[model samples]
Target: MNPLEAQLDYAFADTLPDIGHTLDVAPGVRWLRMGLPFALNHINLWLLKDSIDTPDGVQKGWTIIDCGIANEATRSAWENIFATQLEGLPVLRVLVTHCHPDHIGSADWICQRWQAPLWMSTGEYFSARMMSAGLPGADGSAMLPHFEMHGMRDPEIIAKVSQRKSYYPDMVPAVPHAYHRLADGQRLRIGTHEWRVITGFGHAPEHVALYCADLEVLIAGDMVLPRISTNVSVFAIEPESNPVQQYLDSLEKYRNLPINTLVLPSHGKPFRGLHTRIEQLNTHHQDRLAEVVTACATPRSASDIVPIMFPRALDAHQMTFALGEALAHLHKLWFDGVLTRRLDADKIYRFQTHSAY
Candidate 1:
């Protein structure tokens, strides 16, 4: 664990659920891990023991939270989970936290397999559909142009990114044609407890985190992670967005949660330092923003800021997010009047300190 991670208390410090299995993390909640074919190798999913009233009588089952990507390995893992782990109860509902491929990729498949309804925030649901369909602005095609405008001019990198046009669609081939919407502050009864929806922004469109006061547990989704800082990027669809500001503002929403809330994040171990982790995240961003401001003392493009923020070799996939995140910080500084942006002679956007400009 890193120094910041050591500050929080991990609920299961010595335990991890195997790929197709689960470990009970809270009352009626089981933790499951799935493999991702990226540098970030795993995504945590949850299974909630649940029941609901139906036309005939009370139906007993489970509710799945966050599906793995749609790939043969992931699908095979789900099949193993279904055969051995579910205890023969049906999956009554599929709830996704956001539109990200790892969270919603296999949603349609799971919902279809069990004939369960899909649930998500309106913003996430529609965004998933648009991206899955490879629509104009949401598809990978727009990434190259957007990054180029922010000054990503590497021919080799651009060539690699251009071939990823079907990246999102390939992982998330479809979304359920319909969905049940989850809204901020809405209460949902899953099993023996009620969870209140806490919508967060800047990570993804309307990401929903759930808090169950009764259980004193918060399903933090990507809002408050224990280990790595959540990626808060300015994607192509929202070019001028100041996601860094929006993400910082959204952290305030969790301040009122109990200090010892057991946070079940979408990544990392289950932890018990809600406020501490939030503080760490805030300080992390503040420090990053300070670095960005210092670097902008001279003119800098998003590409120029990428190495300063992420000082390592990046594959094409990581480069896309790196450039987007670099732009996000610049946009935040520009919005706060800490820097000024101008189009240079090369038609690339650059940011500089106001005095320098």
Candidate 2:
């Protein structure tokens, strides 16, 4: 097998073995798999059943864990599934895991249908709104000049910034005018279940993962996926920031969670062993950091170093992201004082050790 495929297989072996096993997660939680043919391929959404009393002795309402993508087909899929499976229950609340398009795309639609209030972490909610509106983030955009000072040039680099400046709009759909802000350690009661909001970062701004201790379940979102590593790329908008470092740091925070707790992730089947996956992800980034350090022994630009890390040919679309992700790692090393930069005679900036710049 090819090295990449083998690495991916080894990383995902345990999770794949029991994927087809039918397991009852809990009385209230139902797992639904949604297909997306994009690079990541799929996303998972959960339906939390809440039994309540009305004029009838008992009725069921639902709290949707995350709204899937906003496309017409995705909406149709959600509609078909809900109609067939949910027995016409109303969605009482729409809880988002993060601001990513795939997760939040249909949020506005779902909220409009059920008149449900949207709930998300305050930072994620505000950032999602800003992203959907095409407004650049302060910290996200602060590092651009640093890239320019490196080998990246004007007009070309400026165009890259302009393109990146619009990424939020490209990915996230516009949310409704109303949403309830959630905070870390906050408790939310829906029907008979009480869900605690656990906020995570580095994957997305203010990512919220829901944990119900009574059920011993965690809606991990993208913060912890079963198969692939979540992309933590540095963008032109966040030129000098080290998203890789941030992502690794964030992974450590989740390592102390209950190891055997069932994790229902956004991209893969529900499973146990959260701490093992967290450790694997942490080690992956640490290895990548080491690779970047080795790559810097000879002065290199972020663009030049991307191929060394990826070691594969990428199309224009892939190239854009590949460059950004490569720069993310380089910036982490640069921030750690392990790397420095110098402007060449041709105006191309190159990076070396701390003494070089």
Candidate 3:
């Protein structure tokens, strides 16, 4: 077994809820898994049992957290779940931890179905709305130049990128015109448990995680994970951002929390060992930073150093993320004075080790 993985202990690691089915993970809280077509095949959604007041009596309903992507198949799966799992009750509200397409894809569809208001962080809510509305910053063309500037010179890849439309609208068909904004340190009552919003950055602009101190359980959006590393990249939209550092800072904030807390991540199974996982992630990034510094011995563009950082076959879709990540690592080393970036005669920017000076 890998030494890094040994630090974490999982609950129901060998089991997953069947499609359109739900698994109980806590009191009044259930786990629902949804299918996705990407390499990460599934995303976990939470169902919180709550009730509403009516003229006659109390009405029982569920508050759904994180709707799956907006697609025919996903839509069908959700419909099936509602048909079988609801037990005659309707959806009360839709709470989103973030505005990633997979998290907020069916926001409009689900909200309209139950006449529920969408809840999410202001940044995530507005960003999703703007992207869905065909804003200027929400297109492949907008990102193509940034990718190219960071060493993505492959014509075929650039052509594919240029023609590709924003995947957000396709996955996230629409956003609710209005939303209930959640902020860091806000308390929300779902069912009988009070879940506090713990906002973090680097994965998304304003990713929110819900923590129930009494339950000792945390719905860690993408802020922390048990297995795969979270994507912390520099996008064209934020050319000068240092997300790598911001991500680490967010992880540190969780270290002082109870190490025995049950962590329900968006990707992997629920696990224990928050402190161990945070240290593992910190070391992983440090190792990657050292590798980037060594790779900078020769002037190289982000694209040119992609192989050094990630030794894998990347399709056109994966290439986009790889370029962004490579640029992020380069930017980190440059930002830390480990490397210096300069444009060569060909107008291509490359990074070299500070020792080269």
Best by TM-score: 1
Model 1 agreement with the true structure over 1-357: per-residue lDDT tens digits:
679989999988969999999999988999999999999899999999999999999999999999989999999999999998999999999999999999999999999999999999999999999999999998998888889989988999999999988999999999999999999999999999999999999999999999999999999999998989999999888889999988999999999999889999998889998898889999999998899999988899999999999999999899998998999999999998889999988989999988844
lDDT of each: 0.93, 0.71, 0.85
lDDT of 3 by residue, 1-357 (tens): 477777789877778899899989888888989999898899999898887778988878999989989988888889988999878788999999887888899879999988998999998898788777757766556788777777788889988898766766778778998999999999998877899888898878899998888888899988888998888888877887888888888887687678689888899888898888998999988988888887888888989878977899988878887788788888888888888889878777899999744
Residue runs of model 1 more than 4 Å from their true location after superposition: none
lDDT string for model 2 (1-357, tens) is 434333232223333322111223666877676656476666778888776566867767888888767777677777776676675788878889988878888899899988878988888788778777866443333345545555444465556564555554544567878789888889988678798888876677788888888877788898877666777776544455677877777776666667667788888667677777777787777888788888778898877777787888765445556667777777788888889867788665677766543
| Candidate 2, residue 78: lDDT | 76
* lDDT at position 228, candidate 2: 68
- Say which prediction, candidate 1 or candidate 2, comes out ahead on lDDT: 1
Error of 2 at 236 (Å): 3.7
* Position 19, candidate 1: lDDT: 94
Off by over 4 Å in 2: 1-24, 51-59, 136-171, 342-349, 355-357
lDDT-superior candidate, 2 or 3 = 3
For residue 234, model 3's alpha carbon misses the true position, in angstroms, by: 0.8
Q: Each model's number of backbone clashes?
A: 0, 2, 0
